[model samples]
Target chain A: MRESRSDRIFYMVNNIFLFIILIIVLYPMIYIVSCSFSNPRSVTSGAVWLWPVEPTLLGYKTIFENKDILTGYTNSAYYTICGTTLAVILTVLAAYPLSRKDYALRNPIMLIFTFTMFFGGGLIPTYLLMSNLGLINTRAVMIIPGALSVYNVIVTRTYFQSTIPIELLEASQIDGCSDFTFFRKVALPLSKAIIAVIALFYAVGYWNSYFSALIYLHDREKYPLQLFLREILIQNTIDAEALSKGQMSIEDMAARQSLFELLKYSLIIVASIPVLCIYPFIQKYFVKGVMIGSLKG
Target chain B: MPDNKTYFYIKKWIDKNWQLTLMVILPLSFIILFHYVPMYGIQIAFKNYRAVDGIWGSKWVGFDHFIKFFKSYQFIRVTRNTIMLSLYSLIAGFPVPIILAIALNCCKNIKFKKTVQLVTYAPHFISVVVLMGMVIQILSPKYGLLNNLIKALGGEEVLFMAEGRYFRSIYVWSGIWQNMGFSAIIYISALSSVDPTLHEAAIVDGASRLKRVFYIDIPCIVPTIVILLILNLGSIMNVGFEKVLLLQNPTNTEYSEVISTLIYKQGLASAMPQYSYSTAIGIFNSLVNFFLIVGVNTIARKLGETSLW
Candidate 1:
């Protein structure tokens, strides 16, 4: 294709605009990383910019030393594992039955699920119900309440409908395969991509979740990483009085203050690691999940 | 008597599919217990709810809580704040992705496009707590990077989260920054599906690149845009409670107190949590969303083929 004068000018302008957008998005994230790695004084005095100055591991060292951070990490990991497993199973089960062409109650049942998506009983009643069911403050509350997403169920149902041909099911049935046997032998094996996508979706949700733990969990030991990060990250800066009443002198207090600031940047990266690491592996499926999930819409 | 054949078909269907029905039992029970039960529990909003007396045993107070909330000053404040913030977000946040998608669609460099998409979408994975923490630190009036830049430029440092005036802008824009890339995926895909032959024909007809984008590309993704806009408007009442709660100080509570956060505060944060009042507020919030989604879908159905229902 020949590049006309206007086309050339437009291309240059668009590329530059794209570059600016990139910087606008990336600068803060890079700055945070640089600050987290920098010396405490560099962070506290606003010296760090896009790159680390006097790089050190002190912030991360402190995070590792903190018993609460460790506990939160473990708890969050446990939640993610159990929650993702349960969510995938529930989604698959609910979605498969609804996806079956032979299922007579599919439309009404689908409405029953989707209606809940639009109107929930709000948080209070859900909390009350959780407490009444003896789920509040327990480990199960984190996984159970969020286990079956109607959105994922719909997405999975759409996947099964699109991918698995009805003839294959009929052939399996002719060979004396029952519905349960066919599902186990045929559908589950063929549905790996959607399963992976849904699992990744649920895992990320569980890992990044703090609100559920905020309202549900009581013990500090059971608090997720984000909640712990919230305590040190938000409360530390907001509650300066708590810092001053500590047994530290002026010099120690200043050092402690920088450490507090540095810890937040470190904790942000720490809390984000699970999702960021898994994101690349699941990037292909993630986009597919979104595409299929938007099928109805 | 005339439905004997239908009964036989029902019997056959049940006999053939009992195992399938068995497969649904676990998740069906979960939904009934967790979702339907809570929908039933919504009745507690009308009761003088006491934990000792239970939801069933509580004395009926009718619309006392709803009326009290309506009469209170916070009724106006939270509702206005919720609407304003959501509208501000809708106006500011909704268009960028469309624009970004257009830009991505035109970009000659695949590498740059992928890089931008990856980095920008990365923030969508970030938790609200952490995002709020970053927002606070970056917008801190004293030592924040933005303030430092402002001082470097001989400008006054702005107390963003602290000032009620700055709260909505900060909330809306940060939300855009977090979500725009992920949301743009739908549009980008839509744009990718746009026929290249149309662009080639426009180019042959001596159309400039900018003109081609407007004439050929923008018109192509209108359905996707409209449907997404409706979806966005549907959840207008359901703003980010975690971010608002995290960002709210005593000074900025007026601007930051959304319906969800208010419900959380009333229902759980206080020493004596007002369960019924909070439940009423929750129901009210859901009702607002219900109406908004329905209203938008109705208008959308009239205007276009794309409606949620």
Candidate 2:
């Protein structure tokens, strides 16, 4: 690997370009975190740049003081845990049989599953259906409608076809193991990598999802963190009525407004921690998940 | 005698495979209840749906709801907004990941490469609402970091979020920034799997690093790019509604009012919801997307291109 002068220049240039991209991507996120920790006055005054100025726990303290924010957190966690379980279970049940080489209805059933992806009932009809089923305003709505993802089924089926050997199934069958028993005993255990990947995928989706809850949930208490955050961020504190609910005077109103700004930054950090904290651990599996998903079986 | 013979075959199959069938029953029924039944429920678009009458029992109005949507002023606005935003995002956002993946592939420094990847990928997991919150916080004209910088630099502060003209670019570019690393994973893996022999052979022919990248790396990933493009085309009508809805204000609604948001608004946001009309508009949107996907897929298959199907 003899390097020419031009090759050296090329390497230098490439590194510089990549370095710029790294800064561009990292700065805003770093800035946001810094702002979250900064004194609220410094945050409002724009004195904080790359690092926190007059760092304090006020933003986090304020976030915890609000009962609404805590409820949002607990609700999102419940949905993530319950929804991921149901999603993974349904994906396995749908995918495993279809992955079997001996299954006569595999392709047709796959077609049915995949067809739903391209064409659907769309938003309005789906809403109507949810209401009709008594899922609207209920906890069941978030977990139920998203239980069986066709994409997850396909990904899991692909994993099964590639990883779980057909001969192993036959070997088990010779010992009087039925399909259900074999899946329960052999397949699920062997497929932990794919399951972990899929579970993380589903869990991340459940954690971040607010659109379903937005449409179905009318109860303020059932609102996911994202949806509730949407109201705080988008609605802003411009509504004097919402502000006055705290019984603030005109002077205290100004304080509430600035506090809300600090609250937004803190709330964003709080909301992101659950998914982002566990992300690194499962990230390698999900990278494998993406790799598997990209290739068709 | 034939019936008896058929029954015997059916019984044999069922006895051997009943467990598998039983396992799929609940999941299959779930799909039926949610996906298939909503599809069946789409017929409300053709009826004057009444709460008392239900979906099927309602008086059939044929294409009245459809005709009403076709004539409405909002129809043209939403369709245009949807297509423009989709194409804007697709054309602008599609290429960066390939470029990013290629550049990262060239970097010999694994530490820098991994750090860059981790940082860029973090935003993809940020919920749409929080991302929008960040957007507002950073772009707020009065106190935002962006506008404050502009003011310090002796330039007029621009309210990026509040302006209609900046809506599409803001949405699309922010989307690219958020999803670039996450999306590049596939392409990066594709580049990794490229044969080293070809690069060696090219270098032997006096190919520079850039030349090798052009000749070897790009050619290897074209099939992947094509398949991804086809998939993108398949779902081009679905500009993610969540972000648009979050970002939309009264001032920006002109540019931001897409089919999905419109449907959500018309169906749910109004005082007296236009249920049938909204459903009709939704079906029309889905049908167009369905046909576009089929058309693109057929063309790809016919041309011997690696298609999504």
Candidate 3:
């Protein structure tokens, strides 16, 4: 292929643009981490640095000292663990039957799930149902309502259907292995990629989720870290700073506003670190799995 | 005798399969209880709901809430804002990812390609609340980087969030920024499946790289694009409740108060809950999305040989 001069120039230009974009996307996160440990005063004064100046652990100390913050972390961890486990189990089991080529109910069941995706009863009925089921203000509300995501189920099913040959199942059946035994022994072992992808998706959704918790959980202890962070993040900076600092004059507050803003960024860096650390291992599978799941009819 | 034998065999199968049933039972029950049953609660949309009266016991109003919502001064404004924001997003926000995917696809440097993908996808995982916080700070009039750059260029700092006109642009564009990389993954995958032979043929025909991309690569991903478009059109009214709620202020409420926010306020925020009204609006929102999905799917199937269904 004869590559033209313009093509080379175009490639160079795009490369430069991509690098700039990379910096833009990465700098806020890097800046947030640096600012979190920097001297509170310097952070307040809008000092920009790639590295922390007069590095201090005060923000971490302060956050750790707060009982509400600790509770929020516990709640979030608990929900993520329990919700992800339940979701993965349900998703796998549901996906298994539907993945069967001879399953008479597969298409209709999938359509039923997809129907819920597009049309839902929405907030009012969902709330009513939760209250009626005695799940309101309970941890069950956080986990049960979102146990099976139709998209994840479809992804898992597609993976199984595509990867697991029907001959394997037929061979197992010839040995007098029952349907359940065949699935547990043969199909389940071969589904690690899809399972891992679905598990990560479920975990991330549970970790980042707040809407369900917001509607169902009334107790402060039940509030997840994201919801608690939401409460802090939504507050007006001057007022929040004043409240935290035990009251200050409105005139004196303007200077401290920048500090509060920095703290907000700092909190983001703090909260996002756990998931960000785990992302590289899973990123390779996510795009492939999502494409297969979404592109299917 | 044959029927009895079949029945006996079916009973035997159930007995033998009870363990698999155990694996599915709890989750299936949860789905039915939480997801499917609440769907019946759409009735409240037509009723004057009272907590004491409950759903069925509540007096039937028969589209009265819809009429009231339609007549309210805020109705047209919110609907317009939602539709326009989503439409802008659909037109502008939708194609940027396709372009980004192509750009990433064409890049020859492997290390740089991975770096770009990593950087872009990171923002998608950042919680909406946190993302909105970053937006507010970065757009702050006092020390915001955006304003600082503007001042450096001798331009005045503008309150991007407070103003009504800038809200939609910022909302839609910011959404594109947060999601562009993550959402483009699907399209990029589709691009990978494009037949290299076609590109080779185009090159032999004296087509330039850009022209080859236009003639070959873009054509291959058309079905993926069309399907994504229909899927996006289905959710045009959603407008993402969390980011809007977090970023909205009193000054911008005129333009930013969307249907979801209105429902949130009425259902949960209000001391005297108007469950019926919120229920009506929720049903109405779903119906709009449903019709959109149906309409777009039908049109795409007719025009492009692709549909979400």
TM-score of each: 0.94, 0.95, 0.92
Error of 3 at A83 (Å): 0.5
Model 1 interface CAPRI class: medium
Per residue, candidate 1 scores C-alpha lDDT tens digits across B1-309 of 579999999899898878777887788888989998888889989999998899999999999999999999999999999999999999999999999889988899889888888888888888888888888788877668898788888999888766788888889989988988888888888887889999889988999999999998999988888888898899999988878888888988878898989999999999999999999999999998999999999999998797777
Chain A accuracy of model 2 expressed as TM-score: 0.91
What TM-score did chain B of candidate 2 earn?
0.95
- Candidates ranked by TM-score, best first? 2, 1, 3
Quote the positional error of residue A148 for candidate 3 in Å.
Answer: 1.6
Return the candidate ranking by DockQ, descending: 2, 1, 3
Q: Per-residue error at A211 for model 2, in Å?
A: 1.7
For model 2, which pairs clash?
none
DockQ of 3: 0.54
Residue clash pairs of candidate 3: none
Q: What is the TM-score of chain B alone in each candidate?
A: 0.94, 0.95, 0.93
How is the predicted docking of candidate 3 categorized under the CAPRI scheme?
medium
Whole-model alpha-carbon lDDT for candidate 2: 0.85
DockQ, model 1, C-alpha based: 0.65
TM-score, prediction 3: 0.92
Between candidates 1 and 2, name the one with more favorable lDDT.
1
**Winner on DockQ (2 vs 3):** 2
